[model samples]
Target chain A: MEKQDQILMKKQNKTYVLELIKNMAPISRMQISKNTKMSPTSITRIVGELQEQGFVKETKLVTSGVGRKATLLDVCGDVLFTIGVELDKAVLKIGIVNYVGGMIDLQTYVRNPLESYEETVQNINDKVKNIIEQNAIPVGKIIGLAVGLPGSIDYENGIVRVAEQLRWKDVHLVRDLSKLTSLNVVIDNELKMKIIAENTVGKAKDSKSSILVGIGSGIGSAILLNGEVHRGESNNAGEIGHTVIDPNGNVCSCGKFGCLCTYISEGAILADAKKMKDISSIDEVFVAFRDGESWALNILDRTATYIALAISNLACLYEPECIILSGNLIDKMPEMKQQIEEKCERYMWEPIKKNLHIVHSSLGSQGVVLGAAIQAQNSLFDIN
Target chain B: MEKQDQILMKKQNKTYVLELIKNMAPISRMQISKNTKMSPTSITRIVGELQEQGFVKETKLVTSGVGRKATLLDVCGDVLFTIGVELDKAVLKIGIVNYVGGMIDLQTYVRNPLESYEETVQNINDKVKNIIEQNAIPVGKIIGLAVGLPGSIDYENGIVRVAEQLRWKDVHLVRDLSKLTSLNVVIDNELKMKIIAENTVGKAKDSKSSILVGIGSGIGSAILLNGEVHRGESNNAGEIGHTVIDPNGNVCSCGKFGCLCTYISEGAILADAKKMKDISSIDEVFVAFRDGESWALNILDRTATYIALAISNLACLYEPECIILSGNLIDKMPEMKQQIEEKCERYMWEPIKKNLHIVHSSLGSQGVVLGAAIQAQNSLFDIN
Candidate 1:
């Protein structure tokens, strides 16, 4: 056969294998034949080829059926790995994940290379190389790289239009990273990653429409509707931090007065905490509040109220199933869960509020990393 | 062939003919054959059957490609009609629409029959009959009936759960309406209809993610994401009007304080306007403002500001291609076009605000009617 013929056959095989895995994973050859509308001989041949490629493995036999016991074909978790990097202004977090979404390695570094976009890209490239070499991981095993940044990203163009934390504007992060590593690179806004994480693994798994609230130094959110992330016209949807909750309260970084983030973010709580005394971090404030510190308690309550208001407004607009609250503040002070839930109940519409669930994120800080890895895997599957 | 086999073939032909009309309307039979992947002989046979059933007709011929002129096979709009009814607490609007989405007749009544759920449904049934009879439309030509109401609707069950305006709880609207009319009845929330309208013919026609703002006596919204209406897990999405924009503002009907609707709804504006002077309608208030009435201007300006804030928040969360302003207020004050766009500019992110186009609804009051008709058509297509 010619090279073109081989390519066509391979493409056809890939499609068949993908459909088989999606529908009948942990299924035997006999079951695949019945389900996939493929002949038993063709199924065996494809399975053999997939096994050789380390994409599928034969598990123990099932004994429930009347016919002969059959070995089940399952996805090989170790066949490939992908790197997921989430770059915030103050810290850079990276995770190496396998095909089944299990994190093989995770690391976080506190560094600010904001003044220069090139330096930041170089730093990420160096770190990725060092991690792979230190682990002695095979280069061929690594599939691709995905990054989530805090800004408006043009996923199609692979450009970061403006990230407030990084103070970068119109940076072609994907092109730079792709050139440095010679691997496919994907980037999107952090909020979109948050939503994707929740949709894939967190509280939003069962929800068709949901909103994931990321309350850290600044507020951001990801809106998932109808089982897909809702990316607005320019891929800048889910930028809820700038919504004005109080028109006369405080000026925001976006030069807006009384934005929601100015009242509910970690920065907001820290600012209020500073009025009483010098509070070093949001974690410290949460700890003090837990210890019955009046000032800290008052500040947390105020922040919770604002957050509740924002959530209620989101509910009214999108009518999502549940709002998953995550980020540095929630991760640090899980005890604030009751306070936030109660406030949402008070603020949201009575009918919608009755049906609403304010749940904490299960994946916590790993949400973005895992989501990025899944996104990269999806791209690979599309290529195949 | 057996009778069943003949029926199945007819159904298949009907579907094929519908698809051909949808894609190649105002097209010749020869063109349809090329587009549908069907043989020219089959296309002719199907077109002949469709013409006999009053579903299609031959129009003028056109010369093309140096070939003989071909007569066009077009949908006969007068052969079938759909009835669309929009029922609110204070008013009822009905329309008769043909296959091409053209309205044959429209009527409005302000009676507030919602005090009794059974009576309201009975009234609708009676009105539907009278309208059909008055127009001398044959009952057999009516394909289906669609109604857009307020509140959360179980589309599958046709149950209305807690429609505040109707003062009804968990009424089996579809079942009840089916008993009154032989035609298939479909019911959904008004916002969902707005979304359907926008997707089918409004500003969202070409864009995948779009938001529709309905500023009537009550403010609400409908969202279209990824080319589908985002109905959340429980069919209660797009309730943006109930979101709390101001914590200390006014108590809303939903028992929330400072919801977006409490500040920006036409009713809210009218309430404020009434306190300043005796006004008969929203149009009167707009007129008063135009005549330099300070109080009216103040109320309208404040209302516009709240609307702008809500739009900004929606932009941040959804980043839609365009946010359409529709419903009663838009019809009353066309000047809101400039006010909303200007205010949105101040609150939205630079990239998003720069590209955002805030436009008045092109469908006007007929939006819900056309939307309902489209909804009925979707049900027909949904038959697997």
Candidate 2:
């Protein structure tokens, strides 16, 4: 073999060792050798170099029968950090995460005084600056930033193509954010980020396939199949909100009549509740329903039916093991679970209904934020 | 390294070389080394063994400004064969395909006197035996059999979970078929098979994310996302038939009201056309419409509207690059394209509408057959 070829082989082996440490640590050299199909000598040499370079460290020692004890190498969790931002229709959330899936910082910003696209961008930049500064995080230690937006986004181009709730069009997000932070920027749809979050750190920790349904002001979902978030032809694979559930129902903002979102959106429920009386929030409506308010129960039942219908249709289509229900509405009203479960049993395939678990989001409203951070970390490490 | 480790390394290198040949064939050992990042000596040794094993053959040499012109190694095209069966609601079509994707034999069987599950299986087995015997095809060369059925399927366990068209439930297809044929068996939803056909041989040849919509007795769709067929949680990903287009419209067989299938199905069009007079088939309805029959045109328009609604919903959710229209009804009515495109323009996202191409299936009736064959081949080779 040529000298250059030998060097390339060594580099590839180093990458493999690094990836192994990142994924499964603190792991012993013998284990790494077995998993990577590498020689014990190679594993030892790579681990020594990584430890010296501050990328890895010996965390513990383990004894083996009839042999010498071995040291376990672990990736240095503090080597780098990632910042995640979720830009929703009515809220903006930020989170800082470490390499080992630990949350370092979290903050929320309400978008009640909604601004224009440029103004929102400026506000986000300002908040990010203040957070980083107050936390005393070094720019060099921040590996990258990931932003999750509510709408169709071009991941490759880093552009938010169209977000109906945000009323934004063709927003060049990555470029704008990169200029301000001087860090690698990545962006994707909020639902896609939610799937990533669940897969990486939340309920779908070991699940090969799962569905994350976000129900708040509008309904949306993210599909994870074969351990990866599915991004369809135009990066709009999980727009479940647009799926038609009521053919002759109310018209959606997308100009379609009777979309799933039109029936189950927070605004839809509030609008229906307004027909009876004034209700400030979904939480208030749920409280009223608990007190035997006929109008509130009726509205909740209708909303729950629509939610169930959408989930049943999804279950028949994807048959995921679990559907993680997130978003503000779910956080406010947990009693809707029974209604959704009952309707799901009535509508979905029997076998699927038997196995399905309609669980609330572990991350709650902060799901998108944590998901965004995980997304950023994934980009930095190239980990699935 | 130990002898056992060395042997394992050699096996890994051999598998890597085989994958390289499958992806980039008609190339030299030097090219394989470059593509796979394997040692040149490893590539040469694996290529030599592969040639001796009859898996690869040397092709014509290519001129280069090097020490010697290298002979190209290519996969043997006729090393194996597979059987594909399309189990439709009305008829069953079968074909034999070679390793190089060439069809060697084709046959169609109409189900005039449809039998029970046991009887149908026995009949299919008899037909396959006769065809194999008549053609003198070697059983050793036949790798497997794949069947496409129009309904939900559990691809993992090879179970026909629930096929409404065939009235099948919990059928252990692989187990039943393996009893009759020694070869391996694979079964999947018919629409998924069509998408496989398009991805492998038809209009969606270059599209990584594409949709195939079958408009016939009932509506169904197959989605291909991220260069892989998107089989949702339980191998039931593309159930476009049940998407509600009218919440208050006619009740569907699935007990849903105003499903897309209710409005666009051949039965729906025929039922609507019956109001004007006697109509035998969708082909006759299209003929009458082409001859300036106002009632036929109206039926076509309504069907197109429902189909457009479904397509628009799909576009918003999946954003496929192209949508292939196929099935008995679409084959007979080509003029429905213009009306669907026009309606889609108003319903789909503006950017998607600008780039979307709605067209007829290139393989037509042969698509399901070819798709089944491709599915068999995919299983035999473990192709994604």
Candidate 3:
């Protein structure tokens, strides 16, 4: 146990130094020692290990205040890679992401909505192999693999408890993937991964805490507090879609009435739009609204109001620095930003709203993949 | 910066040793070192500091595996004291709590609702001074003071941003209290302090994470995630009262429509009861219900449903191990628990609800004061 504690401390110090160099490139080892308050000996030892691992690199020297030349350090972003996979009902996105969360290669594949979890896992294994062989990447450079999907995921056990869209229940994602692949395996909720991407490399890069609200097939949110995912007990903290909005409103797929998702989700909007005209997709509804159809306008206007209410509720609950709008609805219909912000002005509580920013997701289609890869790297990276 | 970091590390190590001794007393220093994986020298140094501070004392000796008698160590609960203040619009509760959260002394005074912040602070100063004089405690033994009240608080700055019940806005609680009291001061939301007490010594003592729901004059919740308050951007994360539950419902005091508090809070229930008959307090409505008044039963039953709904919403959002119901309503009306539980069974989402326990607070009225005092101890206690 004592040895484990020492190892943890060593790893923490090493990660801290690597992150510092990654964030503040061309910084000297003395600067890192000063910033972290680690001894110069400790800094040298950790930096030596990082360099051996091909993570840290010495750049050109800069003259110090006393005219002494000091060598600056930076991280080699391409020295490590992690595989990120986004599993959805109709599509699967796979990518190889570098140490710095940059996507080196990405591929999208159409998935049969009725495919079994086993078949999906097999497909993921095959695709990962293809990506590796095609890129001719050394096996030692790849850290691990992570899959992001929608559902109440038991991240600890890597089980998809229930993903309604994927029609999966109690799927042993990590166990199956581990059996098929040599790399480490991890799985998390899609929104959680999206928030990670936003926090690390996207819109919420400067935020200490943020919430990502996904509003596509279903609505869900993920919270990042002080750089850690606020996974509630059972890793199901941000299932805001199931939160009752109105006791007497429409029944949700979760058997609850007036859940937030039932009113503002893509499926719900399409369903509401079909009541007025023969529309099967959210895009068609927007097209009809663009043509000034009163029913379409009514559906969208009501959707914006409920979206604002959802934001207001989240603000009341989490009070995060920012709430990034994401998923197909926000990503595709960028014009809705103005309406949502306008309604937020009326719906949001005054106190918490003062410092809150309602922003769009900077990562478009790459959020889940990039975030999942970063998560894999985070979980598997070790200083030995 | 380097020296500061070393000091922080040393303090952390000392705190860890002290906490271990407090939790697992009657164990030798060898066992503590084994458990913490700290060196014998480091453990001895920390223990010696704690001993000099009067926090730790040697207990009876026990034979070790090597046949040598080892002296066991334990924490002294009465070595230090902190003042806990629960300030409400109509009442002011002050108490001197010991290190282990035992109430050494307590006092309650009637506070006029129209009193200014300065007047309240002065009253608190006088009351605290009186308690200290009455107890005849040494000045060096006292740690500091902490105040817990309702509504939004900027805890970092010790400012009461807006507490509707107290009609306070932008009131510098810590500054005013500091001007009168010689001790250091801290302040937080009432529910936040209540949950701290619960997490430390009450119903949630064994819980890794818990939520406290205060359902009295208004409804609010405090979340403890891994033993830390999940204070959001403004230390106002759990303001469930302002969360809009119904888009077309009654207006809340915050000018919001259909907030959860507008349905289940004590004031809301009393106002609702008055629709059927003249009612002055919540007790009258319960009396009418006991007498089989249909209107009274209807009102109470609906209140139970919304209370359940509020729990469901919280459960969906937090997925905490347990949600402790407290404040005047839950404490005074134990009979309503069964109804609330039944409604919870019907309202709560299945996946997240399975492991969640809905329990009543055990600390009674001493909760806020004990919590505040402990918080003060946490913030002010130092190992020099």
Best prediction by DockQ: 1
Count backbone overlaps in model 1. 5
lDDT of 1 by residue, B1-384 (tens): 999998887778667766677556778877777777788898888888778877788777563677788876678888778898898878888888887777888888886643588888888888898899988899977889999987878887899987866778889999999898877999998878877988877778877777888888777788787788877656776777777777778988777777787887767788888898888788899899899999987888888888888788788877777788888887878887788778777777687887677777888888887898778867743322
Task: Please give fnat for model 1.
Answer: 0.75
lDDT of 3 at B58: 93
The better candidate by DockQ, 1 or 2, is: 1
Worst 10 residues of 1 chain A by lDDT: A375-384
Q: Pick out the ten consecutive residues of candidate 3 chain A with the lowest summed lDDT.
A: A60-69
Q: Which stretches of candidate 3 lie over 4 Å from their true place?
A: A1-80, A125-143, A178-184, A381-384, B1-79, B129-141, B181-183
Which of the CAPRI classes, incorrect, acceptable, medium or high, describes model 2?
acceptable
Instruction: Arrange candidates by DockQ, descending.
Output: 1, 3, 2
**DockQ values of all predictions:** 0.62, 0.40, 0.61
Every prediction's TM-score for the first chain? 0.92, 0.93, 0.92
- Over the stretch A1-384, how does candidate 2's per-residue lDDT look in tens digits? 999999888888888898888888878899899999999998889888877877899876673576878877889877778899988777888888887777788999888546887788778888888888888887777889899888879999999898888988998999998887778899998889988989987898888778898888788888887788867666786678877666567887778777788778778888888888877776778788999899988888888878877777777556678888888777877788878877766666455666677777788777787888878877776321
- List the candidates' TM-scores in order: 0.92, 0.83, 0.87
Better of 2 and 3 by TM-score: 3
Local distance difference test, candidate 1: 0.80
In the range A135-193, model 3's lDDT, one tens digit per residue, is: 88898899899999999999998899999999999989899998998789999999999
